[model samples]
Target: MAMMKLEHVGIMVSELERSMAFYTDVLGMELVGTLDHNTPGIRLAFLSYPGQTAQLELIEGYADRLPDEGQVHHVAITVDDIEAEVARLRAKGVRFLDEAITTLRNGARYIFFAGPDGERLELFQPPRG
Candidate 1:
């Protein structure tokens, strides 16, 4: 049997430099590397959480883009405290899609937000028994 763990979540961005600033400076993810897909005009950047197994990939290109209306589909990260995380991000001038806390089917708390490219990003923390 083949076992696999999630390598990274890819987000498509219109402006690479702006998105890089948000993810690196604000979100605090370390820039891992950058690559070109060789499709005439396409570039991709990889970022990783400091001292963690998760990674985020930002892809910039001219192609079919994200949906017209509604929040961009998101990649979520679990934090130790949902409320505290939200507050911290809010203090950093990050705006959230929803301020109210929500409970998932499995009983976890989460909130969603938009990144620089309007890509949805979720911050969640699982409930303790």
Candidate 2:
């Protein structure tokens, strides 16, 4: 078993530039990086504050359904061992959304699961050595 820490909050947006500006300019958070995120229908922008707080993920969906639907997408929690954590959660009868773990350009590996209320939850790990 390993410690889990709150990582980032993902939000789907209509406009990437506007959302990025609002987060960086208005919110005063620094832009960590942007990526295609290894998945379709999303343009990922990761931002963070000055200290050890959770980062903000701006996800701009390809489809124009942001106004109708919602912005908040998912919550990510970082783990020391993603495989071990996933196995542990699975033993408790947790349902995984992804067939396999997803690794991004930054080397972070993660898997999505559903919370009690159907909210998307992520278990993340740093780039593997």
Top TM-score model: 2
lDDT of candidate 1 vs native?
Answer: 0.71
TM-score of 2: 0.88
Give the C-alpha lDDT of model 2.
0.86
Q: Which ranges in model 1 have alpha carbons more than 4 Å from their true place?
A: 62-65, 68-129
lDDT (C-alpha, whole model) for all candidates: 0.71, 0.86
Q: In model 2, which range of ten residues has the least summed lDDT?
A: 62-71
Residues 56-114, model 1: lDDT tens digits: 86878745565555222457776777778788888998879986877644465667887
Cα-based lDDT at residue 85, candidate 2: 91
lDDT of 2 by residue, 6-124 (tens): 98999888888998898889989999888886767678888998874689888887557766656687999989998899999999999999999988887989899999989999998
* Model 1 poorest 10 in a row by lDDT: 1-10
